[model samples]
Target: MLKQYSFEKTAVQSFDAQTTLALKTEDLQVFYGANHAMHDANLGFPKNQITALIGASGSGKSTYLRSLNRMNDGIATVTGKIWYHGVNINEPNVNIYEIRKHIGMVFQRPNPFSKSIRENIVYALKANGMKSKADLDERVETSLRGAALWDEVKDTLDKSALSLSGGQQQRLCIARSIAMAPDVLLLDEPCSALDPISTVKVEETLLELQKQYTIIIVTHNMQQAARVSSQCAFFHLGHVMEYTSTGTMFSNPQIPVTQDYIAGSFG
Candidate 1:
């Protein structure tokens, strides 16, 4: 069992409400067995905005991202307090499946199933018991277009997903995630394995998606963070060194550690 604290008690004394803001963490802490992966992390993510979590390896960047969608619980031992929709996600009564429905995730590597591209997207809807053929068709097409890969594959929806290039496969994964209509999309270093052109395509897709979903991305690329995020968070040793508008963070970081990290003193 891990001890936890309320957001108001440990993090922000006052949290201003936002129509677009979809998720918030107040003094969130996470431990894998005895290892504390995250420490005193606090953040507020506005809806329709992009937040980039940037840090060196083993800095708890991905750990913090996983907590939002309750993906960390599969590990043998995990504990943390996360809040979405004004309720504590770590609470016993909270439904994990329901939480994940609204909070989608895209992993670092594209893991498309050994199925057709159209089937991959439709399977999600079908599994969720969505039976409307018209709606399913609309969702599948919309999500693919949203990921910027529809035109290329629209003619061959039945084609095997495995046939796609690395970049296209990643986009298909994104399309599958979006077909679920999640309010918050969590991306963990999604472009690390992609080529330069593919990386730009992924970033561009995210930029376009920000109009309807709150986006949180964990990336080691400082330039990528600076290029795509509206807000940037720098993490060091499980601690959030600073969180602020991207412009302010890169130009004039409030904390010395954040400034040092930005200057490439140490990852």
Candidate 2:
């Protein structure tokens, strides 16, 4: 049996007063049937910046991330306010599909459709009623470029997406997401399955994209979080143990549990 340690909740540090919040959660909680998977998760994601949620397995970091975009709608019971654009998206009457159009998500594994690279990027646009050939063409190029894949696939647009390597396919999926022009991007362990070289590419792509999109990523990789995120939140047993700037969290963790986890004493 694993030992359970109780930790005092540390106040989540606020961003600069001049910083604009892209999204924020208030008293968020998640449950799977009867299992309370997350506690009151109050955190804000700064506009056009990257925030990394880090923790060991089953610590509820992913659960909190999923709630941001209501990805837990069908699988879990999520209660609280997810605020975006001055609206509480957690309301029962809120249109989830509409909310998703503004907040896109990428999963742990790369899941590209069994279509051509061009089709994979254009599919969502078409389904959303985009019909102009010129507009679609421009969007395809920009989205792919945004994902750092246009240079390699420009000459092979008609090739099957499955024909690409795992990393490329993941980038293609990101292209698909960005083609929707979402303001916020949520990534869940996107690089966990990739080789180191591929991981670097994805990280670079993220750094570039943050110029236009607020990003929230759930990752177990401490080094990757340090490299890509401006802020970091540590979760422990369904609660936020500490949330602060990435540099501060790593260099001088105020919470002993955070220090222990960062030091590899325990997770």
TM-score of each: 0.91, 0.97
How many clashes in each candidate? 1, 0
Judge candidate 1 at residue 160 and give its lDDT.
97
Please give the distance, in angstroms, between residue 159's alpha carbon in candidate 1 and its true position after superposition.
Answer: 1.1
Across 159-235, the per-residue lDDT of candidate 1 in tens digits comes to 99999999999999999999999999999999999999999999999999998788999999999999999888888
lDDT, candidates in the order shown? 0.85, 0.92
Please give, for residues 1-267, the per-residue lDDT of candidate 2 as tens digits. 444556554747866778899998999999999999999888989999999999889999988888888889889999988889999999889998899989999989999999999999889899899999999999999999999999999999999999999899989989999999999999999999899999999999999999999999999899999999999999988999899999999999988778878997766
Show pairs that collide, candidate 1: 20-47
| The best candidate in terms of lDDT | 2
Residue 153 displacement in candidate 2 (angstroms): 0.7
Question: Residue 13 error for model 1, in Å?
Answer: 12
